[model samples]
Target: MSLPTVRTVADLRAQVAAWRGQGLRVALVPTMGALHDGHLTLVRRGRALADKVVASVFVNPTQFGPSEDFARYPRDEGGDAAKLASAGCDLLFAPDVSVMYPDGFATSIDVGPVTRRWEGAFRPGHFNGVATVVTKLLLQGLPDVALFGEKDYQQLQTIRRLVRDLDIPVSIEGVPTVREADGLALSSRNAYLTAEQRAVAASLNRVLRDVVERVRAEPGTVADAVAAGERALLAAGFDAVDYLAVVDVASLEPLERLDGPARVVCTARLGKTRLLDNFPV
Candidate 1:
């Protein structure tokens, strides 16, 4: 059976209100369509936490830069709705660009510091788009909990901070990064990889894992280890390394030495597809 979809804010709120009347707690899993196992895991997490799970499939335009793949971002709402139904999602909110941002839409949520490095550095105004949409989603559904994937660690942190600082009455849960058996973090963009590129993509997780082990074995050589990790990505057929540094898991500040809890994060490109992954240290 296909999941019910709401196209407008009014319909979505009505559905949410009906759910709330029955004392059902709502959990939200927002996405840019192109459903994958990683996304389904989030919906399952939502189901585990709340009585009703709502998944939004909007390829947010503002989040994508001019050169980014907003036009090419894979989308299949019929297939996605079917997948969400099987994953136990209660409703699918697939709003169009106009429905989300009308002719006179002029508001944006600005988050500080957390949006300063990694993805924020490379993709300007990305977090602003994220923060605004997330705020809208939280308000639109007033969900009891919101689920986000740890694969986008920085994004997860940013949302956590956004809700806390704004005093949003919703719990933000970070589901662990779901990976393939060989350790390649599943991503919608993974569909862009060619047969050879797909083979090379698994090495991304391997390099990060090696860096984590190296940091554990000898924290003093973190800088050298990061440099070597970059080299390994290039050697493994990645075209370029954006940033490969160990940083505090909380503050996201660069850690010259791993004296405390940290994460090894990186973004590398193969052709036009950029893959981001991180591991705890």
Candidate 2:
């Protein structure tokens, strides 16, 4: 059966209000559609956390740069709804851009420092889009808990900080990243990869894992390990290495050595698709 979907905030609130009246807890999973196992995993986690699960499918134009693939970003609401139903999602808040931003929407949320490096630096104004929309979603649904995938570790941390800083009432939880058997972190954008590029993309995880192993063996050689990881990506057929470094997991600051909890995060481009993957050390 197809899941119930709400487009406007009024309808969404009405439905959620009905759920609340029944004393049922709600969990939310936000996505840009083009459903995959990774996204479904989040929905499933929501099922486990709350009595009702709401998944939002909005491409979020603000998060995309002028040169970014906003125009071509994959979206399939019918397909996404079917998948969500199978995954046990209770509601689908698939709002259109107008419904979300309206004609006079002017605000953008900017979570400081956390939005200053890595994905933030490479894609300026990206997290502002994320912060704004996610805040709107959380407020709109007022869910008891919100679930996010840890595949985008930096994003998960950024959201966590924003919720804490803004004093949002919902609990923010992160589900572990789901990966392909070959180790490629699944992403909606992975649909853009050509067959040859797909094969090369799997190496991203393998390389990050290797970097983590090397750093674990010799913490002082962090710089050398990351540099070699970038070189390895380039030699493995990736066109460009955007940024590859070890960052403190919580603060996301670049770490000189792995004296504390750290993550080896990287972003490399194969043709036009930018692949992101991280490993812990």
Candidate 3:
């Protein structure tokens, strides 16, 4: 069965308002809509946490760079709505670009420092687009809780910061990064990889896991572990290694030594696809 979809803010709010009027809690799972197992996991989680689940499927042009894959990003509303229905999602808000950003739309939200490194550094103005669109989604749906996959760890953190700083009045929940049996983190962009490239992709997570293990076994070797991890990725057939660092999990600042909680975060390019994965240290 196809899930009910709404395109305009008016219809979205009216439906949500009806649910809220009955004292039902709503949860929003925002996605770019190439619907996969990882995305379905989020929808299931939203259903578990609230009386109704809303999954938004907007490609969010603002988040894509001029040279990025915005034009070619996979989109299938009919297929996605079917998948959402199977996952127990109550509504699908698949808005058109014009509906999301009207003629006079001219504001952007910057979450600052949390978005300064890694994905942000590589794809400039990316987080500004993310923060803005997310803020809009949270406000438009006015969900009691918003669920995001930790697969985009930095993006998750950026959203949390924006909600707290802006006082958005919604609980932000981070779901764990869902991965394949071999450990490759699930991503919409994974569709870009060839069979050979797909096989090589799982090594990215293995390298990060090894780095985290090394850090735990020898806290002083954080820098050494990071450098070694980068070399391992290149040797494992990755075209380039963007960064591999031990960062304070909360603040995302590079850590010289492991004093408190930390994470090993990395981004590497395999052919044309960039793979991101992080492990707790």
Distance from true location, Cα of 111 in model 1, Å: 1.0
Question: Each candidate's lDDT (Cα)?
Answer: 0.93, 0.93, 0.93
Error of 3 at 15 (Å): 0.5
- Give me candidate 1's TM-score against the actual structure: 0.98
Residues 176-251 of candidate 2: C-alpha lDDT, one tens digit per residue: 8899999999999999999999999999999999999999999999999999998899999899999999999888
Segments of candidate 1 deviating more than 4 angstroms: none
For candidate 2, the 10 contiguous residues with the lowest summed lDDT are: 272-281
Model 2 Cα shift for residue 264 (angstroms): 1.1
For every model shown, the clashing-pair count is 0, 0, 0
What's the true lDDT of residue 34 in model 1? 94
lDDT of 3 by residue, 1-281 (tens): 97898999999999999999999999999999998999999999998999999999999999999999999999888899999999999999988899999999999999999999989999999999999999999999999999999888899889989999999989999998889999999999999999999988999999999998998989999989888998899899999998889998878999988889998888999877889998888
Which residue pairs clash within candidate 3?
Answer: none
